[model samples]
Target chain A: MKRVTLFVGHYGSGKSNLAVNYALMLRSCGKPAALADMDIVNPYFRSADSARELEDAGVRVIALPFANTNVDLPALPSAIYGLVESRSEYAVLDVGGDDRGALALGRFVPYILEENDYEVLYVVNFYRPLTGNANDALEVMREIETAAGIRCTGIVNDSNLGGETAPSDIEATVPLARELAALSGLPLVFTAYDARLPRPDVPGPFPLTLQRRPV
Target chain B: MGNKVLMKGNEAIAEAAIRSGCRHYLGYPITPQTELAAYMAKRMPKIGGVFLQAESEIAAINMVYGVAATGRRVMTSSSSPGISLKQEGISYIAGSDLPCLIVNVQRGGPGLGGIQPSQSDYFQATKGGGHGDYHLIVVAPSSVQEMAQLTGLAFDLAEKYRMPAMLLADGTVGQMMEPVELPDEKDVEFTEKDWAVTGTKMQRPHHIVNSLYLVPDELERKNFERFERYRRIQETEARYESFLMDDAEICVVAFGIAARVSKNAVLAARAEGLKVGMIRPITLWPFPSQALKEAADRVKGFVSVELSMGQMIEDIKLAISCRKPVELVNRAGGMIMSPDEVLAGIRKMNGGDNQ
Candidate 1:
């Protein structure tokens, strides 16, 4: 596993959910884990929303300075530098949505590329409106890469309809995920699904618990 | 749920607007409603439509007015403060009888309040926010699916009535993701507007689109004609949903996110043997008044749940002619009411206030 991991892709594509889960999983496995939230495009449903839970479980949460504030200023916290510079063994950075969102991640591109031990997983869901097919999904993935100035290492198929997702729904997206992986030349790293549902047949099943929203 | 796609409420409205044959979109960035413009920016140019990120909310709305005059479907969206800026344009559009969709994904505010979900704009939306006499056919969507479906309906109703229409949403619904089956693109058809100010090309008399009348009697007659259209809309277009109301004695009226929260309270109250039901108004302007009026006879009392200081309660009172006491269950300043608070409000209706 890479020391520095990033989750980026289309909006509403479950990037924050996967980032939070990956950090928690690393913490649960007794590794020194730190989570950084770099999203500025959305005001709600942020990984920072679960800062308390992440902090309580021994995972260092470098949350947004303006987490619960009303203002929509694109204020990036200085603490975000810890995502690349922190002494934690595993650092998971949750980038914002799409190309506009990936622009925030570009600042760390040189440092991350120099480190050369990082992984940028392009997390995608075929069920999201903008990226329903492999061709459309590839275009978005390329847009994110260009905007972020980094190439994707792998693909995570986090495809399912929220609350209405069944095992069949998870299974239905496998072919689309494979097609995206083939087109983008990125390996199929894993397929994420709701942990409550029984794990369906997919390569590298990464069961996920939904993110806790801010109270 | 056929071939369902997951989408945020803001994005859903954008896609559904495009599918509804709206080719011109003008909006400025504002939280909770920013994604709507972002989606339009990405999709509009690819489809040969006009998508402008105007310098100001006022500018965007006036551009919407320009597009509407040419008899093409047009829209502009903003949050609370931005919506306030567009009020004058909305009134102008209504006065001119030009059809357009103006969306307000509301946040807390008297002036630049928090970017959290709020229904505080109820009074501004239902009553006239702009000057003079007019109503923008307003609709409130509780879920992302309705956000998509109602966007299409809003454009249809605006064209049919030849006035401005609004989708009154809040931050919660505007930001939440839900599975939705969008309308097929092939079905979107735009009808001809004989009243449009399209250039004559030396063919016939020019059709003028204007709200200004130099004479008082002429302006008065225009106002009367607009009111007649409003009267017909009020009679024929009031839509709402009734939940667990057939056997309930205590009626709860809410809309948008508050209504979604109230539904859970209604379910929990029903489980505890409390005869509580909910009336969710789909149309806030043509406010499903007859439903509440009908429910008033059977229901013992009413509870109006909201994210504002009881704005919708005013409509509830008028809808039922104040025959029953309408208590308020609300939280203001960007706070959301939980199911427990709403259940407590329901309990008060049951007996807490009796003795």
Candidate 2:
């Protein structure tokens, strides 16, 4: 695993859920992980919305001061800069949903490049309207890369039918995920599935617990 | 016309707006409504139209005001919280009588509520959210296809009435996917904007677009004129869809996504030998009060089914003047009422014991 992993995807693509799961996975493996909620676009379903749960699991959560609050300002806290610069074992930046959301990532590109050990994975959920097909998914990826001033290193198939996801759903997305990887010239890093479901025999089937929204 | 393509409700609204001759769209990102902006970002530039990701919802609606002032069809969309921010601007548009479309893909809210679908904004949409004696022609679309069809109709109504029209939707309707046959591009001829601020160039008296009147009498006159327009709208523009209401003894009053669920419950009740039908108010502002009142006369009782805490029930009662008991079948704070729950409500209203 890379030291810094940035997750970016379209809205409703389950990027925030995957980011929380990835942070927990890293911490469970005895890594000092920190998940930064850099999503300023979406006001809900963000990693910051689950900050309490993540912190309870021993993951350092870096979120904006106004996150999950009534204030809708796009204000990022200064602590996020320091968190990004810190030498944590693993840092996950749960970025906002689309190119507009990924614009925040441009601010940390310099520090991320200085680290030289970061990976930006363009997460895709084929079930979403815009990213359902390979071409549209690639289009979304290119748009995000252009907006964030960074290219994605790999593709993560984090596709699922919300709480209704089954093992068959995970297996069915493998071919589409491979096609997306091949067309975008990005490696298929992992296929994320519900941890409770039976694991699929696909490459890098990462298991993730369903992260419920904080009350 | 395009072939039926599977599209999210948000994307369909965007495409439909483009086909309806909307040349300008300004919006800030908000979940359940962000896809509309994203879709516009991709297609607007290609079609030589303007798609601006404004600094905030306040800025986006103000941009709509600017674009609408020039007699161009323009729109802005947001979810609940964002819609609240745009209320002041929407009021300004209505007071000025500038034609524009504002879409609210509502989520739960009193403050920063959850991002799940909710119909809690019925009062906000139909009752003039911002401060003023004004009204927005509110249209509620239930299905993904209606999300497209109603968008075009929203632009038309806004233009026809010279008032802001809102396409009030919920998160479920905005996020869900369904096959939609997109409307063909309109061969529109630019309407004569004698009242527009497109610069007179010393040809005629410069048209000023202003929603202000310092004199109390002038302001009163403006309000009176606006109210007369609304009265006309109430008479001619109130739209609704009646499902199985020919012999309905129990009527379910609902709209938007809640109506979709209520339809299922209504059908289930009919299967169980209950004469339950549905009245879906498509135009929420010039609400179908007359139609609902007519239905109330025939039905034994009424059930207002919604994703909110019975916000629309008040309207139903007011429409019928409490002739029949109106029961609420609802779930608030983003919790959807299952068809079974609605069926139970219908059963209870049908003189059966409550579940």
Candidate 3:
């Protein structure tokens, strides 16, 4: 089964960064990766905005005909169906920010879940709303599942995007992630480098898988 | 045996959450929803559960984030204004795919509109309360008993999908009292969280949970995958209740309290010998358009009866594909239309259609 990775987050929560980085990592590892831009929510930060950058890196960018709109983006291209058919090494889907973008999740659930095996990694930023706590985060997961009709496969605590983020913020959020893991029944998948961060004095047998990426 | 109790919609949700194995409750008090917070606060500590009245809606949702991260069932309740405050948080939660329940005892909105029974927030709850490209498992309850049942389902669905689920009740549903037999607490498998960061503890690996992705291409991938899940939701989870729709010549499309009122209107219209029926959307987010489409094929026309000024009418029109005339019966800004008033609209439409 081809490994399809989906990068999801709220607006300005750093979903795009992770999607791009992961795609790059996959390509550099000599794996062919296809990146599809399906974010009809926020048109500004879409992967199509940096189409050249992805193309330069040798990743196939699935482009939409018109600029994305909040209410009225054209139905997602049929190419998405073709790509899922390809069964590439990694197919990256960069979703829009928040629940409204989740509406777009409606268009694709049938094709993807039935066709290609996909991993939905709900990335969280502790500083972000809804995800700042364990309980609320679980609610977010449920909403997505109800809206998208697919169960969450994993969780990514890529809690920072820019300046002013501290290791303590990550420390403070660890327990929340533990609870999220227990609730969703999925493992907490994270970067291996995070182990160097100052550990919290919390207890856990967190279901986590470490992914080592080139920084 | 758990205690059987009669309670208001708001209080029943509080009681039902406790019965459903939810031990954590966090929320700030808002009008019409104040009772729910009070009930949770009163009951949480007694049962060794946790309840905190946060300083603001943002704080409350963030606290929900904190507790949900622990992999426990939890919930928050608010009226329109407070729900507005929590929208940012709701979006973040949707983005991160967290499982929690959000109860909205809706009041008039577009900014602190009113304290009366209103369904004005129907669009917000069913559409998207938060700023992200996301959707809540928005369930609009028609009765106080349903308020209890849906709240428990909200928690179950929330955990099931790893997404936010909302129990949408109007002020009427929240405040109205009714007899209810809350379900027995059965052992539910809160499984599938082998991926959550309960804590590394030197066991497997360090885990991170976030909605932030700085890469453009990667974000696109994520959004598309979320779309995949939404499609599945549309296919399997869309729910609505149809009353006398199969053989009726005319249909009323409504939800929540409006559906209840429309039921009376449909019956009265039938008494007057007008073939009328109703389609009530229980899952407002999924918006049982398919049912309406099927109904539209049978009915000559449709009337979208809502508490707001035609908010849901657009959906009815779209669903019917404009095959026939779509009329609207609505009252806005906390005013509710009586069954007689709704019947009048149906009569007028029928009167015109027949000629």
Candidate 4:
């Protein structure tokens, strides 16, 4: 199968929950997306949480081995291998948060990108470490590249992590993201938020925010 | 749409990441994997993506942690030394049970060894690269096409297990050039906000992503829970590809580029009326031990071929458990085993045994 999307970011930047929502969004659109877990760095809140829920929603959840200690043995499932070799379209992988987690990509990126056709997105939140400024963000990118062995292709301005985040914050980070884009010669692909937005006119890339209506 | 282009294994991976919907790429420069970063630098922006050349292997992996926290499909690739720097982050990701893809287009070493492809990381991946108790889902690609295909699978499996997945490649696979078909872009669909903390909306609370469990019992519980997931993963992710094993007297086991060369040797041997078969491992972590054990029972002996001195050969021996004599045919420090070299080893083994 082909057409898999990977979600990556630094620790505490909120990629797991984002992965779940994004997978759900794709599912709502009548697409059969699969969620694969490749986060081998951080210690919590992974895509495995919604496995049954995603499976119930017709999204296949790639399962991982459980951990008894912080260092529990990694137990990868067989279907995972099958999926890597499968013919399905639209698989979503939620990578671990941090440059070290990114190191896991050392071997497969060549194969996945070439044979199956996948994409890698660097989720940049201005509030996090090494991404606090244009230079810091660039530094983070460099670190990720060092770990992954590939340069980042673009930036995602996901500049919020709860606690009274505002539209202005996202707006401010947009320029930084753009600046990073310019420096790296990569496009600021898209920006995302958990709340509603005013939809700014500064448009070179797509901006998306997560705002669910009240029940 | 046909984009059948000739490219080196490294650059090919960079291009494939874009097609696979990988938008965030991070990594530092390392031999064998450098072309991948150079390629991402030129291509990521043209299609709206982020390509960053990180400061160090440690920082790169931490950045991956940040971006991955946002629940995006991101990747980082490196060689052996760079991979070593990422071990701490890898341990954390495993403890936390996050899903991400790590590629190691391996080069030699214990420490800054050399710039040659080596399978020395076999134990690191299967046995756990860091100090903690975690196992990565390691996939070993023997060819350029497999490099791309396994990357896609690595993402899927990572998500499934909430664990780190590795694409274990060698310098030969990374530096070599080959013709490959890129995946179509029209098929990908992303829904990253489901569990990602894009700042808690008015509807939910803030999300916390970490690997630290300060409370002893709680941490213990978390560890056990993670083990449960790994247990399930083991039942599912073991993979291997076999060739001409049905009536063969000798079976060879190998992975990554070595397997490709061994396949050729097996064919050459078969042409000479020698009953030989080759077993190629696609996933090195959940090793196909059973398959090797079965082959050991049926074959007169097993030969493990690798670019390293004798890394994966140990696994073969452990799996076969002295059922049959397991021989080693290796080329270390940047040297590759030519078909003739491997065949020679096989012939010598046959002669020695027969005598």
DockQ of each: 0.66, 0.09, 0.01, 0.01
Off by over 4 Å in 1: A70-72, A86-88, B186-190, B353-355
Candidate models: Cα lDDT each? 0.90, 0.87, 0.74, 0.73
- CAPRI-wise, candidate 1 is medium
Q: Comparing candidate 2 with candidate 3, which one achieves the higher DockQ?
A: 2
Q: Write the per-residue lDDT of candidate 3 for residues B228-322, one digit (tens) a residue.
A: 88778877888888898767999888888888888998999999889998888888877788888888778888888888877888878777888
Please report how far candidate 4 places residue A91 from its true position, in Å.
Answer: 53
Provide TM-scores for the models.
0.97, 0.71, 0.61, 0.61
Which portions of model 4 show Cα errors greater than 4 Å? A1-215, B186-188, B348-355
Q: Which has the greatest DockQ? A: 1
Model 1: lDDT of residue B10: 96
Better candidate number, 1 or 4, judged by DockQ: 1
Indicate whether candidate 2 or candidate 4 has the larger TM-score.
2
Give the per-residue lDDT digits (tens) of candidate 2, residues B1-355: 1245556789989999999999899999887788899889888998899999999999999999999999999999999999999988998999899999999999998898887789999999989889999999999999988999999999999999999999999988887766677899996557769898888889999888898899999999999999999999999999999999999999999999889889999999999999989999999989999998899879999999988877889999999999999889999988888899999999989999887
Residue-level error in angstroms, candidate 2, position A109: 13
Residue B243 CA error for candidate 1 (Å)?
A: 1.1
Which residue pairs clash within candidate 1? none
**Candidate 4 CAPRI level:** incorrect
lDDT tens readout by residue for model 4, B1-355:
1234345567656766677778889899887687678668766876788988888989888888777777777889999999999999889877767777888988878788776678887788778989877889999987767777777788878877778888888887886545555565634576755556577757787777878878999988987887887787766788999999999999988888788888889999899889999889888888888889888878888888987778887788888887788788998766677888788777766764421
